[model samples]
Target: MRNLDRRLIQVVPSRRQLEHQQLEFYSFVHFTVNTFTGKEWGDGSESPSIFNPVKFDAQQWVDAVKSAEMRGLILTCKHHDGFCLWPSKYTKHTVAYSPYKNGKGDIVKEVSDACRKAGIKFGVYLSPWDRNNPAYGSGKPYDDYFVNQLTELLTNYGEIFSVWFDGACGEGINGKKQVYDWERYYEVVRKLQPNACISVCGPDIRWCGNEAGYTRKSEWSVVPARTRETELIADKSQKEDNESFRQREISASDQDLGSREILRDETDLIWYPAEVNTSIRPGWFYHEEEDDKVRPLEELINIYLNSVGGNATFLLNIPPTKDGLFHENDVKRLKELGDFIRHAFAKNLLNDAELAVSSFMRGYGIDNVREDNYLKYFRTDDGITEAVIDITWENEQLIRYIVMKENINCSQRVESFRIEANLGEEYKTVYDGTVIGYKRIAPLTPLVTDKIRIRILDSRVAPTLSFIGVY
Candidate 1:
């Protein structure tokens, strides 16, 4: 038990963190002066006169997001270029000076209103590095200006789900680098929107180490508290995932982040889950030349199965064109992605499963996992870290996928597990995995079997499963 810190095993996600994890799939709306300039990072010299998306329709953006089964949209309120989507009284470089709506339209307000009206969550991405303001590298003054803009987004928007920030620091207009007030900015988000989860540079969510739709074969949610540091991850692969994709001091992306061996030295632990993000096109912003370069349907599906299914929420960026709408090519791909999700999850083969467990803890039994609702789950007695779950069907059935979810509310504990199917005469391992946090989606090689066995090889505490499903 030397590596098993009860304190670490006992760590749980806060209400807001738990709610954010369940979002599973969401959209990152990256629209700004960059879209028009065909630049990924805009220099602070663009004119607001050329920023109009005359045909811009926030509703269309929401519709595209909703159709793709995404539950929320995080719009880029401002980028490193220092242009504000909403008219901020603190800066003259905002949508207020744009020709759209005759210099009176607020893109932030329009998007937030559309999200609320569509019954989906709204979030904001406010870059910490502002390159336009003259006081950019002046320390406290820039932080103050940043906080003022942050406060405006949180208060003006009805209910913000996420306050996304990136660690993209560079020399500003004055040719000096900024020392960001990370703690101060976190406080403003906490005070204004207590329910919102501060993502990336903040505490609630961690970047999944890349923006290439890449995911770890086994993504773990519970990590040592210090792992969220930008300095440590920056020097290594784990450190370079955020801030406009900063180059890593090291080149490898696969790193052992959370394991019993890794956690033994840590006194503090946290449920800082990962958010996997990538763009639909080659770049974060729309460029007509890259129109045909939209990610293929199969690539998108693989990203979903690996990210959303691998203990991290998937954030796919679907940028708007210069005309203020999703490109037709991107829209077409979104529909395909939506249809694939609906058809794949329409029916749960587990409905026909007769579940039985080797042991149970008092009232917690097999029935808890029968319905993947996250309310109740199957748990074993203390010291029973290893157990077996038997699932059977009266008639032979072909199982294509097996999905498992841990009631992380109870704290993530299962360390390793494998699924076996009775194909002919004996049970054979079909899929194996580690760390099932909020959810884990595993696909089988397509087998016909009447029985499936789940072997929980190890866990931090008595293993618990909120839900086990077959699809």
Candidate 2:
């Protein structure tokens, strides 16, 4: 147990992925043809005459999103119905054909402009399944068409922060499945917005195997990396079959790809994180009947704690009404949630705690540490699997939230950890978990203590922590 020279396997995220993890929480704008048709999956036959947003206001959308403290918004520029919000030369089913603004107003342009004006990030969701295109099932011809449309969006929109995709594939006009050219799509995003992340159906970010806005207690961002060839074939594969190995589930078994253990023989480890998506309403599209069903402020707070707090980003859907504006109830709920979150985490209780580590690497001592500094480290040894940080508070304080972060530059190493409060001479365990990637926010029952301890029970290698905060 004394081999001190051992090095843990390294798993680091790309620059774009790092930026995405920092966002933590954002909103998804599912406004499109489906909003008017009252259908989650709209057929390609929807006429342009019905697509109108008389009182459309992009600034209002930004106001709602900003009020929620969400980092940005992701607009559904197009859905499965093959309708486009922006005028694209590749198709006639766009805003150009719609009577709104005499076909001159571009939803994408307005939203992007509003996001820039509001100082928030902007993203786009372009569904790959086109039920209207006749060339969809025609192999190369359909791929060419899809790429051209993608190019138009990437080039026209001002600096998109994320390009999202959905794996909703279906038979086309020719009664054959249209093959998606995912690699080509990635290439286009990289060329146009190199800093943007391709989310969910793409590589940089992945779906959490469920759309219920919840993540597992032990969600790890490091997973096996797949080549371009494997990615192309993965979309069409059945999830219940061998494809299950490639997919990451919220409550996946310990042996799953994103589980705690390393699956070296199966796939090379890479930093592919999870994204939890759920709508604010009962449905993704705004419905008149569901107006009163806007999720309560408490529920959204819980989701934010679980998703954004569980080392994964939360993508909450807040659909716009057919009149092109967020519902009044939804806006109020968002503001309430944002206010609660900001107030709850306004100050860190452990900011001035006398922090001490059981063992640390040289040149990584903790003194006058800031919020995001990575100078603190507990270098791992072959015989050592545990490290402890004892914090002596200036005064006994009641705290309900504990935040932990790993120096992901060295990869996600902590597999299991625990937090305890010292009561007299005895210590009581308050919280424990399996992984801490970029950030892990654990909300516990309020506890009053003058001393606290963090113990790393298990790790792939010696672990390194960037920050530990209590609020």
The models' CA-based lDDT, in order, is 0.86, 0.80
Cα deviation in Å at residue 214, candidate 2? Answer: 2.5
lDDT of 1 by residue, 350-396 (tens): 78879888888998998798777777888888777888999988988
- By TM-score, the best candidate is 1
Q: Which candidate number maximizes lDDT? A: 1
Candidate 1 residue 147 C-alpha distance from true site, Å: 0.6
Q: For every model shown, what is its TM-score relative to the native structure?
A: 0.95, 0.91
lDDT of 2 at 469: 78
Residue ranges of candidate 2 with Cα displaced over 4 Å: 1-8, 226-255, 259-264, 373-384
lDDT tens per residue, model 2, 1-471: 122112224568888998898888998998888888888778788997799999999999999899989998999998888999999899899999998999998999999999999999999998888888999889889889988888888888888899998777877767888767788888888998899999877888877766666567777777766622334334643222122333234454422555443454544566788888888987778889999998888888998988888888999999999999898999999999989988888898777688887776566654423366565544644446688888888789888888888877777777789999987768999998878877888888888899988898877657777777788
